[model samples]
Target: MYDFLLSDEARVLRSEVRDFVKTIPRQLLLDMDADRVQFPKEFLAEAGKRNLMGCRYPREWGGRGLDWVSTVMVMEEIGTLGYIMACTFGVGAELVCDAIIRHGTDAQKEKYVKPLLKGEIFAAECLTEPRGGSDFFGTTTTAEDKGDHYVINGQKRFIVGGEGADYFLVYAKTDPHAKAHKSLTCFIVDRSEGVIVDYIYGLMGCRGGGAARIVFKDAKVPKENIVGSLHGGYAVFNTMMIPERLGTAAMTIGAARPALEVATGYTTRRKAFGREIAKYQGVSFQVAEAAMLLDACRSMAYTTSRAVDAGVPENEIRRLVSESKKFITESCQKVVHNSMQVMGGIGYTNVFPVERIFRDVRLASIWTGTNEVMSLIIASEWYRKYMDDRASGITRDCENDAVEAFAEGEKIYE
Candidate 1:
């Protein structure tokens, strides 16, 4: 369905990524899902060795310098391994590198971005705090200026790779007196000194991705380690949304794909009422619906990737990405749910991978900013853009298209 969206080069890159995906050990997946592993270090290491990590980064930074479309392709292929593996890949390749590339100084990039894409070290985005996840501006984490460096103090919870990551892209309030959007700064906080992983949370799914709470009490970050300018974290954040939200949207589609495939194959063999279950509308319709949902989801993700690549306006990009994330993730849930129902009771068991896929995709709607938040962005941006365009005569005033267009007395206002 997405063939036309890719260039020939992207197709080649996708093949390389698929080859790397094939090399992943099934045992690693099983171990992670069972919580026997905290992080899969070898997974990223092997991907780096194969030069298959971070397709969109510069070749000097150990990337192919591919476009966002290529990265989405990379995401979907890795996504089949399950949520944790794909997310682990994304945290380093997309999330962390995005902030660095967009805002970090050259020295900082050489020090962090190169090693990260090389898979020599792991990275994490430490954003969500004990205060809240969606309300990022409500962060209580603070970094106080102290001449040569700053002392960062606060706690970040539910951080993927919190335990295994060698460094973190941290957001902290740098100016108490300033407005929320201007009060914060982005910093590269190493996992040394005052940085501490105080607790590890047992997650419902996407296990073994090093989900934990990090406590930073007087963690000294050098003035040089700050990303972008002082009090500019919000800009870094708004830009990084392209990777965080869209990456999640694309991955969920790949993650849930197996469920549809597995269920479809089963319907052909699983018998009911002495005939193939697939012959029944109850069964076939579910498969049809799941397939349709995935195709639709793919369209949104691909379109949004193109928009970001085309240099669409920031607000427009925000609306597009939020819609992609919300719609694709929600579709993933229904696809998994439909697949489970189609396969009957056996689908709920570990005998098939449908159950695991179900567990993983269930968190998609909740993470990378919830679908509810996406709705807020969608509505807010739509209204702002539409009104602005209408006032400027860029949009046709279709309000007068009705037959009762001149019935002003009927158009009462309070």
Candidate 2:
């Protein structure tokens, strides 16, 4: 399928990228791996210098202006190197840049987005609070209008890139009196405004990018710093979800491919009782199944990428994006788990990267809206379409019409 799907031009691009990534010395990656506790600002700058950080940004904004496919290629290449580099940079490129492009005003874009494109600073999405994880809109963070500025006060927990980021795109209640989703607003809050980041966390995996808990004590952002319209934070989020899902799918594919390759290589070399472990039917079969699933999931992700590139209708894009992300992440988890199973003890050890892959890919199901969340979106869309079609008389119940006839036919047979 990969062969059939990729055009000659795409093949040429993929080959060029693959060749380039192979040249990255393993020691450089190792050095990056060692510095995974917080964002290596210097390291990100170097990546920006190489034009890696801003791969998908518009050309007008200092990005390479590459399409999503190209972006996916870069993610896969970085992931093949290691998960840490891929994920750390992904927070900036995929999530932060995504929001900026969608919701940022020209001024906001000029100040934050440009600097981020150059990798001059890291960025974080401050959505989760101490009380909410997936329930992001249930935020307790409050931002009040104070003439020329807004004063923000609240605690945000589990903020990715928060500890080291120079900018935070914060979601807060702009109108407490407004109902449900309408109360929230997004602000491009600079970190310098008396904003405090505390409770920095180390992770089981993805330690390359810092995730922190932050507290804002009457932090002030200018009135012009508001992203999107007043009480329109939800739209900003919706705008990012499609690209976020696609980008996340690419990352998962990258993580899974390498883990599987490591397992396959290990099984072929490591021996048990005389022959290589890969010679065993048990090992071989597991590898076969995992390879098949991972490839299928990868295809789904690529399909979504193409859909995005072609600019499919928004609803269709959303459906495909969700489907691609849900399948890829779910499959990657199973694939990584199988890779671990095949490697047995070695897989569990820190020496092998499979354990890290397992941890990293597991979060994919939780973040970018959980797999459960994806299913709900897909199912709701499906039901909405079905209901709309029924109301418009586009579909008829053949089963209902044939019910009495079938019963009569059964009587004749009897």
Report the CA-based lDDT of candidate 1 relative to the real structure.
0.91
- Tens digit of lDDT per residue, candidate 2, span 254-367? 878888999999999999999999999999999999999888877787778888889888787788888888898888888899899999997998798787778777777777
lDDT for 211 in candidate 1 is: 84
Candidate 1 local lDDT, 215-280, one digit each (tens): 999999999999999999999998998899999999998999889999999999999889999999
RMSD of each: 1.2, 3.8
Question: Each prediction's Cα lDDT score?
Answer: 0.91, 0.78
Worst 10 residues of 2 by lDDT: 28-37
Question: Deviation in angstroms for 346 in model 2?
Answer: 1.8
- Candidates' TM-scores? 0.98, 0.89
Off by over 4 Å in 2: 1-36, 392-414
> lDDT of model 1 at residue 101?
88
